[model samples]
Target: MDTVMKERDLAGKQREAESINFADLSPTSGFFFTSPFRSLSTEGCLTNVSEPAVDGDVINGKFQQAMQAAFSDARAAGIKHPVLCGAIPFDKRQPSALFVPKKTHWIERSAVMAAVQAQESELPAVLSKTELPEQQQFMQMVTDAVKAMNDGKLEKAVLSRLLEIKTRGAVERPALLNRIIDQNPNGYHFHVPLEQGALIGASPELLLRKNGNQFYSNPLAGSARRESCPQQDAEVSRVLLDSGKDLYEHQIVTEGMRQVLADRSRHLHIPATPELLSTPTLWHLSTPIDGDVLDPQENALSLACLLHPTPALCGSPTRIARDLIEQLEPFDRGLFGGIVGWCDDRGNGEWVVTIRCGTVNGDHVRLFAGAGIVPDSSPESEWRETGVKLNTMLRAFGLN
Candidate 1:
């Protein structure tokens, strides 16, 4: 009895350990996401995307009902633990790409990084480069928006431009992911599947995060390009912290979020001042917000939908700013400035603001970046800010 029972017990334990072995994944298919805490790699689909979710009240949200149903479907299919991963579009009217994967492998973020080899990855040669709005047109758009602000049209409008790069050969997703990881290790790295191309980027802004009844968000605004010299970089960081125009822009985002959380939170805390947060390419004014949920039913997706298009991404007086943005900006935003992250069946997840990201499809990639504009904002300066922001992704391709 002792020998046989012990052998069986040892074998069962080994098999359980083998089931969770880290997956060696290819970036071309499925979904992948890594935050400071953990990493998730998924394979086949357990629950594919359904029809677009209907927009409802703040708590029910644009994707909440549909997300809940998807979880139920996975549970019925005998999946003990189900987690949904994908991107939510900037506009709820557009179709989103959220699904529950059939097989999932979870690993620690540190372990994933430790597995990385230091060898340089190869990228394709550039065939051509194009900007959607061109430089002059984008500057003009900014000038007009500033003029409108002077006319009291709205408090602010965050404007974005798109840059498309064509390569002689297909850009390798694995190589690009490696580059981003090697370059920006402390970011919220994601590669979410879209209807057309995959949305891949390392965003520094935390849109929303929920664990049970507690939530956290850190929005970034008022950025300055980082200088190569340490002294200049430090000075730039100091100036960014003191710049009144930048401070006003930062407050617009923080105060707007404070109002949203005030209505939905049982308790809340927001500092009177913003702190400086740095990335590989830029330094930004960041405000971290914390609160406990008033409604236990509101999960990550629900809360994300409610707080998205925050003043940092869109503008204050959201409806009015969106109207102006629609009238001024030429292209459809698609998933830019939207939220991307994962939520398990338990409703705990992290969503990052989709900044410093690009859409990759075959041999071509489209990168998007934006700058927050207020009345005192200069057109040329704003244009330069956007270019510096694009450097975050450009460096991943070894271009910056």
Candidate 2:
């Protein structure tokens, strides 16, 4: 037990209170935005911030080791319960949603979900589709990104795009809800709209979760969309597994997680090999990392601070990749790639990396999508891949 609690008995009582669950607060009709980036700041309202804790700076190997050291230090300090979770900051380089006040009449879920039906709408045309740079120019972007990789400047850079969606008549919140309900598998779909704030993504990455002295994080790095036809899907999965570029991307993420976990805990189990998973539209190579937390004085937010910006979302050799991004990309990511999760008094929380998401601001909505760049990654192909990522959120808006 961490020292935050006076004794093990006291720790039990505190953990009970901290574990209360709340109804999902996703708004019925208001505007909202969440960054893909998660931070201690995002833990507001979910956890009591008064406890003494240490935030792990996961910028380099040093910061990664610091997390493990902090955990052990907390246990030594006599803290009874410590929570650890992952948080990633928003990609400030891409177009994202900014939450604002809802000026329209507030409609209850009953009203919207009752007789109101979602109307058919057309997506805004890609005006001047030809306006985008030529293939060679776009290819230039890939060369530059690759050059950075060769220079050991980065392992991956999420180059994305901004797509616009428009709905006619009153926007149908229920329609969107119904669509998600119909499409969602395993009843895992959760609607977390930004309230007077905005968030980006229908993320599938579970960055971290904390319960007692134990902690968990699910890092998703490689991707391939599932196909309806079983045979075709099998073939697609096979292709993804066979892809050298995709495998390289997955390796970066898996290795990065292994390093971070080792830094925080002694005993860790990471599959020597990654498994393939098929989503509605893409496939991903996933590896689950689990360990006993070494530090109890710190909360889940602190853990998230260290684990975020992992190779899956960001890149390996993080600093160099980040620098190249600062030099090459032309957009601000905001929260599209940040983290979002909840925490409690005893320091228990669960957070996920924001991905497959978009930002909705009033009538105009700006969606974001990114593709991981690797040594064999093609710029033109990567660009198209991002379009696939964009569809995750776009489909949520009933735009497709």
Candidate 3:
């Protein structure tokens, strides 16, 4: 028994060594996981007085300041091109996780490495059983969302459901978050630590970023999570792109983004069409709208702030979808569906739409997933869609 325990310990150490080596070797490294989500609210450039109005200029101003700070620091460090991405709140909603404990730097490294090591760990060993709704309940939710759309109640809305998970011991969850970081090297991976809250699975869709005179906004909409079979996955992607339901959802976001950029930008180019993007789990139809800004006044952070609760993440005809979301959804989305990213003075940064995410409220964690509802969308299918989205985060936790 001791030999087995020692062997496991040795393996954990080896994983730790590998993770630290990767971090040391990589030219680009910054904070990752939900912890950064909460920390930024209090400690980083995102910390600033918020505007009273939902759509106010205060956030914009603060965001600009944040860009300035990052840029100034980067210039000093001789880092020519620095990319920052993480979540920032739309409404100044502070994290629910009250006080996060400070870990020594080595412990922090361990936390990240431990998450990677646990990727292959058995979930049944860690997760407690929570009764998933019978298939009928999931179907009913779908039916209702679809009926609402038919009745003209929903132009588009992101309806999310919950899956309760129980864990043994102290609920060592961050270890799972780190493995997610291990798998994903393309974008910023963040986890916002909450006091008595949950975690999130976020791959941001909103990129209000700039390089020199080039400015771009990549708006993501319409998604179908990937499956095991490549052929089936390709079919799903094809269907999602061609589906009137999915296209309708994607178009609303594209149009809204174009309008925003046109009104603010100097020279705008509308791609004659929408393109598709793939993440580890799902396929997304993304539209990248670029324009030249003669003024060059808009900062990525503020622009992203204005675009928050977008139709892609929230819903369309903004106000109506928001109203319906509040009225029907059982839970307040908090930061789960909020934007989290960073920016520097050069207008260079990436901000992902907060989806497939959750927050930690102490030992208990709440995770979230949402799906866009259009006229042709089936509630059951949408529910399953969220399930696939949830896997992005759950897999991080080594749940799958």
Candidate 4:
């Protein structure tokens, strides 16, 4: 291991524990976001969910113009400060589900628990699970990807699969949200209603955050499932820190992020090595990055859009990896690997790389998870990684 990794390995071996008491936790509808800086809930859309008029760049094109226009309209309609909040789709061409809410409450997590009135609904028993691509097929897909990488098709690609689940009853969003917050309180927890269902999850990767001229992001990659035994968990974390393949995968993401943000940022601070970040279910190599935006006019949404499809979510050499995903995966990603959070007119907001999340539509819930397939990636390991990553949401529903 390198000197930086060695020092981090010694210091970050212990996992931090966070406990939450649900005295104030409650069920909420509409949109919700809980980060370290602020926790907010907004309801009742004042304007329609605005989408791009033309399909081009995800952030640019008429799409951004339309979003900006929506803010203007909301302002003219007499709202002092309007925030456009929703989920951006995985494919840049796909339409976004952003709108201006009529009411917004910036409250604490405890207050949300206190506001709870509805009883926790019993989550449905699992009827069956139909993987979009079966396990064996997924492994084969991984094999093919490795071959392609060896043949020089691309450096890496993030291949995702959907666990199309059927339950005895419809999945309840509010109850599930409460469970998620209760279990994994430190991550970025979010909810935004969709045309069909709601996008809900607690994500560890912060694509970008804008507070005045300063911006921040925490990107996580190279992860492993936590062991029940403390010693076993520490051993696994150390292995992840030392694994050359994992470190290379992490470098692809952080370095690529630095390159993308270099021009947008006046100054960016990135550590030479990543430290381990623990969620309730897994251990991830995380790099906390921050900087100042070159332009004060840049909205958090636009900056996130600019950095979307990073190697962490997509792959190195983004276009090629994206194309590979299109050809390989059986399902369209939609908003699975996209971003979730809110951006306001003041250019201050937070957006998270939508992972460890799922979509709930009545009796069905399609959960999403992916692994970065590099040259040294193993099909079995990658498959196991996805299962471990899915635990964040699956555990919330009281499933193993």
**Best by the TM-score measure:** 1
Better of 1 and 4 by TM-score: 1
Alpha-carbon local distance difference test for all models: 0.80, 0.53, 0.56, 0.80
Predicted structure 3: clash tally: 43
Write one digit per residue (lDDT tens) for candidate 3, span 1-400. Answer: 4423543453344232213322332111223432211112112222222222244224345434444555556556665534344445533334312121111011233344444554553323445534234456655655665676776756777776666665654444445444556555333455544334334454646455454455666777788778789899989888887878778888887777776666666788767667778778888887767777655666565566666767787776777777676666665666666776555445544466666566544345566677888777776687778788777767756665
TM-score of each: 0.92, 0.69, 0.71, 0.90
- Supply candidate 2's per-residue lDDT for 295: 68
Candidate 4 segments exceeding 4 Å error: 1-27, 53-61, 113-121
Higher-lDDT candidate of 2 and 3: 3
Q: RMSD to native for every prediction? A: 7.4, 9.6, 9.8, 6.0
Cα lDDT of model 4 overall? 0.80
Candidate 2 segments whose C-alpha is farther than 4 A from its true place: 1-88, 91-139, 169-178, 186-197, 397-400
| Clashing residue pairs, backbone N/CA/C < 3 A, model 4 | 24-113, 24-114, 25-113
The TM-score obtained by model 3 is 0.71
- Candidate 2 vs. true structure, TM-score: 0.69
Query: lDDT score, residue 60, model 3?
Result: 47
